[model samples]
Target: MFKNGVFYYYTVLSILFCLLSCNSDSSKPFEDFFNTTVSTEKELGYAVEIEKIALDHIESSSYIGEIGYLKDNIAFVDYRFCWVFLFDYEGNLIDKKIGHGKGPNELFIGRISGFSFLSNGQSLFHEASNRVFVFDNNWKKIKETRINWKGSQKYGKARNIKRPSAKEPIIYSPDFGNLKFKNFNKKCYFPIYSEHSNFNGLMGGYKYYKEGRILAELDLSNYSDINILRLLGRRTPELLNYSYLPHHSTFNFDIDSKGFFYIAHEIDSLIYVYDHDFNIKYAFGVEGENMDTNYKELKKHDVKKFRELFFNDRPKRGYYSDIKVFESNDQNLLVFRSYRKSISSAYDGLQIYKNKKLIVDTEVPKGFEVKYYKNGFYYSNGTIEEEEEKISFYKLKLYHSVF
Candidate 1:
């Protein structure tokens, strides 16, 4: 009789738990915030200190390709020559060129995608054909490692996959061949995609995409001639529903000086914290004020319908754009860019987290997407239209009164 009572008690408890879950809101992935040891308290009196600037296109828009902020200079991939152009801080062109090759037969570069000066400031690196080419400041090739991408797979046959109706930049941007190398040079994070990814981001009747490898890491370092094993984050069981959702698959991440990884997905509000091995530690983030999260579902649409859906949902809706990490006043800082429907200005909204706690969330001037951080100041390449006659970049600095 005593054993029967114990079993009954546990069964009753499980029934109650299941009922609660079923009654809960299942429409969204995370209806509540995830704060494991973190707290969310908006400290007043902290404001985003901003300085303004203007842009009047200096050269033909074609010169604009990939842009990066070096410590003292700015680098641009001049497509005319298919090489990198390092310019002075004043936006004036400089003679310093990094890679000069245009095709596979060139010396060091082939089908160039992007390049940046590493954090060490002594070496430069560029991506081409799934390989990273590291170069010394004097422009000498030092290391080349081919990324073993095990997640890309062909979906249906080419004829079976659907294509978008929209034109360039809106319905599709084919320039995504290179991996995303935001700030970290020692490591980089890239998204997983279907081999038929060129078929306009997503289609219908697919069970999964790319084995759910949402994020993959490339250890672009060799410590004492020892190569660290690459990390593949296949943690995407929660993503299959929204896996190929438009404008939300791309994830943003950063590795702090402590070696902990911080990742923010486009559709979700939670910011996940992970250890060096990519094990999720905890997550903490509050949704931005006056944001839109009602994303459109996928339908088997041809090009025209796809274009209409994409344009209608892209700008009016809200999503996180990019994230960056910095060290300020001996405290770690995390800043991420977000788009909001409530804001009328063209400037993107940014949330600042000091020491893993949010202090301020506000918008800066247009073109303030941070590209470089130096001497306690955050710098950006600024939002400049290539068609505009000229352009200029501004430096951003955040001020906290409490800290």
Candidate 2:
């Protein structure tokens, strides 16, 4: 008699929980956001082939950072050899200068943080020394400017600068986890981040698009809401703003030239497209693919043990790590990386979409980390030798699919 009473009490709680979840307002936003859907039963419409171009001349001891390209076909590769390398279209080293030192004609001390392409033949970089250096197309050092970290902002160093989209001369820097915009005269914090404190998680990836459309991805342990914030404006971000609920797992999203957003959840194979107003445009997924296979395995383990391992060391299961999107004149590309269970390596996949149809579902080669896209190819970095003494940079070519 006592056992029967316990079972009845638990049954009533479960039914109430379901009723509350089904009546939530968050469910409506997801349903109304989608206008169209593409069935994965359709055949893939694109093919891909990678052609590896070897930078054999780069020293084995040098580490390659990110690769930047010029319209004239010049590739500016950041080499940890303490300088930036300039390469021609044929992979031949043209001129490598950007020295490492404290003197004139030399880059600032410490490793090359990153390189930014300024207009014409100019580029900029900020190094570990917290100084910004400017370079020309000829590998010549144009100027070095010291960042003035004043007031309460002196704790974090500014890493990179985002050029302004409007007539304002202000540029933004990822200061630790916060956004700081400055010009030659004064500096200030982005207004939204100033007003909302919790949204300031250590910023992971950010894009400042044209007309003040800002997409910022952060790492926060808050609720299930998607960890992205959309802001519009320069000096103060006070324009169109909206955030969607993740509802399940943490994911990544990117904006295209047309202001459409492409988002993919970590555990599901489905990819969603949303408009600038946060309405779902369409959704598609890979047919017969189980992207959540590892997530299910995680559920079988003890909850306490899983939490211990995740916080103290590392999680015991594989999960989606990142997602990236690239928009070109005729096509859009989506790339996602997943950590494989019981393995140290990750699995990378690239999908291409054209004319509202899925085309490519191919794997990126192991070892190389794809960074950016240009023309019809992608750029990646890896080590050519196992001894950690040498590194190799590659350019990948894409083959259009016929199916």
Candidate 3:
């Protein structure tokens, strides 16, 4: 009788111990059990056709903002924060005017976070803020209207705004390239912040972090009124285990010719596809080989610790960067770019999906993004040289006869 009683007591203690362990380690969900990795099929063969475009005029800073195409022959590059360099398809310098100024044509603070060319001979620019600027084809500012986004604070002056802590990210915005600034029939979309998203992201236990909304739309019919897209960065399970940096929490969006919108969050492998109405139609994705997820988790809402983790460890880690979809020769191609995470390496993951089926899951040149696709060719800016005057770009062509 005594032996049986001791055995039952030990079994009860063991069960309690198991329950405690599971509760303490609740951050890792079921998906965390599988470290999924993807690689190109052995039979697939890919090549990058390199083409460099030279500029005739002098270039300014190395910072290249979003590039906007006004026509088949006209293009403009947002040069740094002060100027917009306009050129043609043949690389002819057209204009170097229109920048930060108090003039009628100039902006008080000229920053092109994203842009979309309108069909009615006008251009729209979003500075990652609530306001949208409209200008004529001549680059003269026509009107600037503040969007009607409720629960959004006005980013009036830098000094007036409150910060979560000193030396932290002032704002977290992901609408970087032209791909992110999309235009459909009567509505246009741009990436905006989640009002203290960076700080909120650190507090993973809160409800706001689980329900963060990142994208917003501007209706040309009613320019003042705008609607924020659905909650984007939903608690992607893998991200829960680590300290979510503001940048890693960012995402990019693009719209295909079929009017299907695609969003790729930085920390997720799933590419969310939405119809014109912004409804979640489906999700498809492919993760990189040897992607790292073992990041330091910040349980406390400490801004200093989060900054230290981002600066020290974020560089050596790989994460999804952006997604872009384009059509080539009657074929629809979707590409997802990811950082290889090697601080000294130049290899980024480029997964090419042809018609929703991944045909090429291979590594390509670092920063080898498809800038613009035209006439059966894809173009991307080459690494900018601070000392070299002429700007260069790489024209990439993917051969599919092997696959």
Candidate 4:
């Protein structure tokens, strides 16, 4: 009887210990369990026919800030010169307008920050003036309405705003900053604050997915690993763990039409796709490539300096320039950008992935930023430099058969 009682008491104690351990370690880690490293020795074998179109003739002093698709035959280009241009499918300059003044028709050009295309033929231009300008298909200024979003004292500014419909706007908070809604009957939303860092902003990859699953980037440079926040509508956010592979530098993220999340590295050539549960769905990339290999590993502090470190040449490191996704016919078009150690401002080349598999790595001409649309890719070289003045833009079409 005595021996049996002793055995039962130990079993109860063991159960209680396990419960405590599990509660203490609530967050999940994604290092060895989720690492998807690609080889740096494979060569790219896809053909992309490039064509250049000159938009500089329209406005010599203007440069392309953002490019987007309006319809099957229409494209909208934002010119930091205080105007937006409309182009046809063939890249012909169709119509344009200027909204750079404080008049009724004109807008505070400095306040015009971003734009979003709606299902209707109108586009919404978000401005720092706390208003949005609605432009019709003919480039006519239809109306300008005020928005409810104001910069949060905690979060620096709203990263982006998406209006799914006319009802309410979905505001994306910055990774390192705070986002607070003014008119809404809600408390302050999310704030990025920690003891180590004074100011916080998102590293990148801020997406609002289906059913209120917001994937936010967390800057964990102080710690070894970065964090991913899975936030619901009003409930507390669940923190997920992520680690950087040795060769991988920046981890940018994107989501497809099917709700699959893609985690792309700036230095490493490989791209990883994760399901809703954050499991590695698929991994693909090329070998002997990716700008990461060209760089020499610098001190860990170099990561904090990012651009400054490269410019000073104290410890040069490769930087991930850009990452975006285009969804079509149930397949995902992934774009990744990488830059050399010396020239961090311009992208070295772009690696295009179709459905998570590498299709091509196109080395764009200098001073061009390549953007993907439903039909094809647009490379704009209008933003900088005297030498870049020659070429305005380039349209590229990829032939998958050559891959």
Candidate 5:
């Protein structure tokens, strides 16, 4: 009898121990579980080299916006010209079709935001019109849906009153007056307007008008917004007010692995991490030169520095062109693109940041583009003065793995 009693007691103790471990404090700060190591092989300035292949015409122009690879060795490319091009793994163009209706000037290439590939060999795409379109493996249009929004009038008037500054390139909408309403592909787009007011005099605020918006779908849906936010920063109410009169606001959101939704604003350069229940986990990045200061303050003191440190130093506009998130070995890798006319002939390059710190600066030759792939990196250089357009793929070599 004593032996049986002891066994029961031990079992109870084990159960209690497990219960205690499972009850983690919900307020704990997010902990990063991955480490990043740089390559040590002489730091080649341009590590990627392109191999020329016969160019086959898929679309009228080769200005590809988004690209995705499927399980069956099929690749999808989104041409900003309102078309989706499907290719094989070997970069051979297989099929192409227009994304919009047939009209000489009716299809605006700028309206298409992103394209996504599903496990079922279908593709999903979003447009500025606030609509999401689904296509099959053969690039055939399947169905289209529009996101619903309430209180759009109030949001619209708020946007037009404040617009984005001229110096800053508008990431989302170029025209504030004709803002689209809907949440296609889980995307929310809001318009910014310029307004003259006391609280945000000469400055603008981004009204929370829309949600469930998709900008790009290279990786899992959960990683999209977080990837872009890490590249840009945050949009402030004051800054939104400066966008344009009766401006609108759009939110592109995706839930991360830990049930946190990563949100990014089109006009602002900030990224916000929120729990599944809509509670904010943390916010990263700031506008202009003050980003460094805000980052340092946030690190030194676990206090929220959203308003004081970042908003105060917001620039009139300018800086940063694109942001993307890439994952390798279960770690989130951020890539930021900055355009500087004063730099080399091709003044675009990828700034690699891990854990909110700038680590390596990989330059993309002039007229070329850089994107992160599953194994390594993909780059495409458009033909310039005497060079022909070319694309290349490379794998990243880590110092730890080599030594």
Candidate 6:
């Protein structure tokens, strides 16, 4: 009896010990969880490197589609004239041809949203009709397939309405290709915006197309809604003015090579990292500002004043526009672009981040837009000289150790 009693006692003690160890929070320090370092020096400052690429007669209009680089040093760019032009690395136009034509059921001078070089040495261009046109190396159309637009009804209902009209079929922008992935399926994710909402917002949905038919549809409405709020609040100050809520949110929505999802939502400005199965793994970020106590309590007449205080309370400087993960030196580095105010103007400088740390800051040349590229960042001055009507491209050199 004593032997059995002792064994039971030991078993109970073992279970209790296990529970204590499992519930222990002593090892995980609060500082390790939350990054509280506010360094001005580590903050990004802009530097410019100017190199001119010759273009004889590039159009003045802003182009939407991507510029693809082939293995043979060929650059393919979309022109507003319903054509894709092939150019050499030296900015000399090599060949240009019609990508699409106006027909009974064909695209009519539609804008190209994305251009990609497929693994088979072919090119894929996503057009306005939710279709991807495949082309050979010589800019010849090989095949065309419509991209599936998944969750149209759910996306429509979110806006308190049915599907969009034929004339206004919730057209998608090329930014969908901006979602980073090593290998892209013959699929496209579209962002649908609710016209009825008081706030300008949208949801992300995807359609998978194989052969000539849509094979599958994925509804990302729930996940997209969660992300939309965070995206809206972070980028646009005007939206934050309406909500006037103290806490802001951040979501890191990423797709892996296998098309699985990775989402990290920042609740009350506190980050929560989740994998495709919605399992929480890690989190980091600052807590939301105390709106009630921090801002002066004033009645309805002070609405504008209230908004100013609310947006001002948060760290206005460090907001990121987008984040992408890429393989570098066998380690996955998360690259993100951020904007900072220039001493002269607002939103003038560009900052790059890797692994949640600032790495590079490319300065804008008086007036220019900086875009993130795979190898480096591209800067373009939006001005078009009437006589020249040519666009300029500047490449920024990155220091790798910053990641």
Best by TM-score: 3
Q: Order the candidate numbers by lDDT, best to worst.
A: 3, 1, 2, 4, 6, 5
The regions of model 2 sitting more than 4 angstroms off are 1-43, 72-81, 118-121, 128-131, 141-347, 367-388, 393-397, 400-403
After the best TM-score superposition of candidate 3, give how far the Cα of residue 84 lies from its true spot, in angstroms: 1.9
Residue-wise lDDT of candidate 6 within 279-352, one digit each (tens)?
33454333212212232322333445645644564334333333344446656454333332322344344444
Q: Give the TM-score of candidate 6.
A: 0.50
Candidate 4 residue lDDT tens string, 1-403? 8989999999999999886654321223324224555433333456677777654345533444555655554444443555666676566777766557776555665644555454455555655544556666665677665533222321232222222211112233332211211111111112212111211111222111111222333222212222222332210111112121222222455555555555544454456666644555566656323344444333333345544433454224444444566656655464554334334534456666655556676566553445445455644433333345432556667665542
Q: TM per model?
A: 0.69, 0.52, 0.72, 0.55, 0.47, 0.50
The weakest ten consecutive residues by lDDT in model 1 span 165-174
> Which runs of model 5 end up more than 4 angstroms from their true locations?
1-55, 59-82, 97-114, 118-121, 127-130, 152-256, 259-272, 276-279, 283-318, 330-345, 366-372, 377-403
Tens digit per residue, CA lDDT, model 1, 185-234: 56655544443454434554333332233444446666223122343343
- Clash totals, every prediction: 10, 4, 0, 11, 59, 1
True lDDT of residue 375, candidate 4: 50
Off by over 4 Å in 1: 1-38, 53-61, 90-93, 99-111, 122-128, 141-179, 182-186, 196-211, 222-231, 234-244, 300-312, 340-345, 401-403
**Which parts of model 4 have CA positions greater than 4 angstroms off?**
1-45, 60-64, 72-81, 109-111, 118-253, 275-280, 287-307, 310-317, 324-347, 367-369, 373-391, 400-403
The predicted structure with the larger lDDT, 3 or 4, is 3
Query: lDDT tens digits, residues 1-403, model 5?
Result: 9999999999999999777544322222222101112222222232333343233345354455544455533343444567555555466777666555554322343557655565456656656664556666666665555433322234345445444222121223312222322122333223332222312211223222111122221222442221111111123332333333122133334443344544545344455555544345565544322222211122222123423433443222223434444445668545333322223233444444455444445444333333334434343322322133333332333222222
Residue 57, model 3: Cα distance from true site in angstroms:
4.1
Which pairs clash in model 1? 55-390, 55-391, 56-389, 56-390, 56-391, 57-389, 57-390, 165-303, 367-382, 367-383
Question: What are the root-mean-square deviations of the candidates from the true structure over C-alphas?
Answer: 10.0, 16.3, 12.6, 12.2, 12.7, 12.5
What lDDT does each candidate get? 0.54, 0.44, 0.58, 0.44, 0.39, 0.39
Model 4 lDDT vs. the true structure? 0.44
lDDT value for candidate 5? 0.39
